[model samples]
Target: MSLGDDHGYGDSARTDASGEYGGTGTTRTRLPESGPYGGARRGRSSSRSLVTVVGVVVLLIAAIAFANRGDGDSGGAPDTADKPDTAPTAASGTDPVKSSTAGVPTGYSQSEQGAQSAATNYAVALGSTGMFRKADRHALLDALFTRDAAARLKGPMDQAYSTGFLDSMGLDENGDPPEGSTFVSRVSPMGTTVEEYTDTTAKVAVWYVGLIGMSGERSTDPVTSTWKTWTFDLSWTDGDWKIVEDAQTDGPAPVPGDDRAATSDEISKAIEEYGGFTYAR
Candidate 1:
């Protein structure tokens, strides 16, 4: 069966016809009423990642649960009292940091521009396929989050991305798809805006488009794209911006396009050839 959303860790529900991992499940399961992620099931048309902030990241929906821990500024955020209604589209000309930590961009300036850059990069990292794997996920958390936040989340996040969950998404214990299939999960940032800013803390929102699903002739889950707004509450810590906590919501998505879907081979080739960029203000 095919899953939806590009958050990549996997979140779709369907009872298997043959009671196997990749079985042809005809009986569609439904999400629980208690919470958004509890047994949650979403249609193909759902606009964004399926996770909620209250608790539990059941698949593509991961809300890092670092509550009230970051942001030392006590002045309180004003309701855009002195800020512009919208940010300009022009480039800031300041170059992005050339250094990297655990393959993530690092060394951001302690400014509004730096916060935006941190948020954008963090969004991409969180929405990637690596979040599905054990070692990679830990490394990513280390690079993207504050020390305390990452330590608190590692155990819970591990539980959320369990072996059963991986099987449901047609991925092995290593977070790999079938032998011949290519699992595609990527996030491309559209733009960013600062919701609130301070010397020690900042809230930034990133509008992005994501691709998820498996690409192969034998694959049932062909790659599909979705739009989302991922907002991060960042704290300037350890010489750079680090995530305290984050949440995601459905877009501000534009109208659907009329273009035809590309083949699995084509999609695989394109992904292999076209590398992503290091985003900055």
Candidate 2:
């Protein structure tokens, strides 16, 4: 599927792997100017207002559900929720190659399962805090994408995380978090599905929850979670599956739970103490 079909907030669309950067009359995925989810940052007032409205709507729905629970209407459809059918612990019957390039898992087998693995891992990399830093972002692009795609994206990606953008997010010119603040940007894949597969090309969708923003006592943008589905078009290139193009959508988000939000210090400590894993099916 073409990446440009949708352009919602936090969405990105890129040219195909074979397309040249500004030479083949093709468009590249434009990263947003602000926000940790790769979108133009919203004003605090607007964001807070939207959140309040959504919270009220959710509470009203819950209250209505509770009031109607005993009305004897038990024929409602099941909540499929667009989640994966299999459990996370179930084996996929594939042994992933324990190889990596520049800290990203690599050497995936040329199969549908391998494509799913690669897509999910690449999603994590693309949504990472490293993407906010120039050097680390360049390294990740080089490692996770085709050579042409990496070269094509460097300029635009750099602009997206420009100095002005960093300052807007309270980061320094070097994209470092402010002292006493911990910047958070992490992607946790809930599941993956292969949309279409061929011998040399595969398209996979990764449903994930991402945590982003800064954690600190004086932070204006406290860490928040977002749900999104990242669709990757991958090609088996140079002995590994590399990203060709990709797109993202809001989500098939589940109902919000009643868990309390953690403190900034708690979030900072947890981020430092917990290590991420190399996801393999």
Instruction: Judging by TM-score against the true structure, name the best candidate.
Output: 2
Q: What is the lDDT of candidate 1?
A: 0.66
State the weakest 10-residue window (summed lDDT) of model 1.
27-36
* TM-score for all models, in order of appearance: 0.72, 0.75
Give the CA lDDT, 0 to 100, for residue 65 in model 1: 32
- Pairs of residues clashing in candidate 1: 51-61
Candidate 2, after superposition: displacement of residue 98 in Å?
2.1
**Displacement of the residue 206 alpha carbon in candidate 1, Å:** 0.4
Q: How far is candidate 2 from the true structure (C-alpha RMSD, Å)?
A: 7.3
lDDT of 2 by residue, 148-266 (tens): 87887787666656687778777898879988999887888888888889999998989987887889999998887767787888989999998887767777767555456799999
Cα lDDT of model 1 by residue, 155-245, tens digit: 6556556787777666799888898788887888899999999999998988987777778898876677777676778889989998876
